[model samples]
Target: MTATISGWSAIVSPRYLGATVTLCLGVALLAFNGFLVSTALPTAVAELGGVALLSWATTVFLVFAIMGGAGAALLKERLGARMALIAAASVFLLGSLIAAIAGSMPELLVGRALQGLGEGIVAAICYALIPELFPSSLVPKVFGAESVVWALAAFGGPVLSGGLTETLSWRAAFAVNLPIGAIFIALVLLIVPRGIRSKAEGRLPIVRLLLIGAAIMAVSVGGLLDSPVLTGLCLALAAATLWSVIVRDRTAATPLFPTHAFRLDDVVGAGLWVILLMPLAQAGSAVFLVYALQNIFAFGPTLAGMVGAVMAITWSIVAILVAGVSDATRPRLIRIGPMLLVAGLGLLAVALAMGQLPLVILSQVLIGASYGASWAYTSQTIMEAARPGERDRASALLPTIQSAGYGIGAAVAGLIANSAGIAAASTPEALTGVLVMTFALCAGLSLPAVWAALAMTRR
Candidate 1:
């Protein structure tokens, strides 16, 4: 099969089109859930009476997502991608239903956990399938197109969430996933062709997998708990479990994460840096921005939602522009992306300090642009670095790391905000301090990416 094709031709190809659309729909659903919940969550917690467990709503999903993603190769090896995807979609749908009707905080968390599992599996498989479905030359364009789907989901989700909450109930936010999930499942069944299944797997280490999952869950849920003692203990246990897993995986015939994935070489190093820091800079700041607008600027839910939408739009535009130029000079684009991110976050921080809501909104445009360029370049760089056969595993690992990073960043930020008493303070001073901290974190994260990009360009 040819590895290179023109962008226009790739888009029109029947196989490529089918796979892209199916993957886009699946990813869009995931993005929509993430975006909608961010807007609706404050209200959800108020109604559910579990402000303590608030962060769990996001962190739990991320923890399971990493575990599910890590286990995806094992599952796909045992059950084929087609079956794996179907199972994931079904579980996601079930989770959505549970969350939609959850009577208590625990039930809602349970639903979120299930959804996270499904999301992880689906995301890993979708990424793994990309190289198989498209030629090498077409991968960038196809992946770039997928970014558009994510952007749309991000842009529309907040608006929809705000409107739905105003017109109906916050539970209705989850209800939106039902139809999307059903359609994604249907399309995958009808369009995705059966391919050669993986044959190189021993029995899955159920105990180790469970340990890893529990460790991730502990850290995620622990971060949300009000008790610092419990959170610290859970984090310690999580660290221990991770250390044990690393040791065991080294000796195991088959491991959850590929052994070579951790290599600190140029391409792999750059890819991992992007994976870890993108969320730290992007999603982490997003949490702060949303709260800052609501609490400090006195923006209603609808206006805050609109600000987020603008960010998403800018992200899409930058992604497309970067994709168009990627073939000619990927390393250069990668280098510049991080600098843009740093500048954006700097502007955002200054705006918050000055109590300028309008300026803050403009800063989001900068953030969005940086996110777009960096995300596309990072993904392509990772794909390029992997061995041909290992692409699936590499792709699967990307999202797992991304989700894990987001969870860690948010959890850490939450701890800081909570400890400083910023989360509860109704005053603008507290809000500004929190926003400043978030921006500082984002800016700090971007600096490393800048160095990574420069290193890549030098090569």
Candidate 2:
């Protein structure tokens, strides 16, 4: 009999329960880890002495994560789902141990990169497992379960992580990942089959991967530079490298992105721009939101983490509400989302200037809700808009592009803050001024993103 997605009961039924929990665990591991790290990293930096390298915390993880996600399919093909999952979990566990024991900023970053690589693959594999393990009718339920996981992580992850950091230490926060990863591996052994491996087509795109990595590194290094002229040169080099990679990939037998990947005139291209810019715009907030709250509001770690989570919490709730909207309304949402982001960032900038807490809260809600209201419709539209031949590649590339956007955005925001003298700022007012620049940059990105959203919807 086909599994029915009639109610929550079916998902929780004994027959489906273990598999459901496993899949959801994979997602939860990734989401919860991200929130935990975000909330705890500031403290980690304080202990480790990498004040200037703060943004690299996010930049390095995201860069490595994009690479991991892109390579997941091939990994699965070689190792089988069972082994692949165990390997991923083991790597994540190892990373947690390294991070937990780290005595320096560089050590923490290495651990973070390993964690990103492992978790990225785990999440991707979980997505692949969904279709195989559940009937078509139940796929929605599986995804719905994941949304709840994300929501819970957003709502409570920061507070829990912050509490752990406060009571124990920043290292304690990382140690939480150890047991979770072990359980994940155990579940994989119990539930996943050994014969799941298969021959895969195409070698990994080593050259393209290198180009992407180099570009991100350039952007990140540029952000750390003291000289504005040198920063501009680094940005230019990064851009040129990215463009060259895309151009080269268009003709690759195993192209990383479609031929029309970033073409503004094409639907997938415009939609891809929105994917890239949306996260890129939000990255500053991701990297700096908690820190800003701590500085300006004098909030405790727990409180600052909760405030930082408002955006994600709002986004998750709103996304669920908008999941089943009509096609007619989705197009409107595509435009509305970016516009809301613009408004959110603008309000945040002003709120910081005026030291208005309520306004700051409102801005976070608007920005998080913006993504919930629009991201799904935006993604569906982009997938549907792609030419038949390029459709699959375009769709697969969306998440990866979004990851790249965040990495690049963090680099840009870090650069802006460093250039604005955040390192030298001794008071909350000075820090606020520097953070405002990042918010303003996000607001500025809205123009092109909204334009692209409009363009994509028309297709």
Candidate that would win on lDDT: 2
Q: Please write out the lDDT profile of model 1 over residues 191-245, one tens digit for every residue.
A: 7666667777578787787887888787677667666567677777877987788
Taking the tens digit of each residue's C-alpha lDDT, what string does model 2 give over 1-459? 332454546778887899999989988888899889987999999989988777787667776767676666556666887888898888888888999999999999899889987887787677656656765445545555676788799877877887999999989889999988888888889987764554657777888877877787787777667776787788889999999998988888667676688788887888889999988888888878888999888998768867877887888678767655555787888889998998998889888889999999999999988888888666666656667545445555656777778777776777777778888888998988888887887788667888888888776
Candidates' RMSD to native: 3.4, 4.0
The count of backbone overlaps in candidate 1 is 1
**lDDT score for residue 393 of model 2:** 53
| Top candidate (TM-score) | 1
- Residue 434 displacement in candidate 2 (angstroms): 4.4
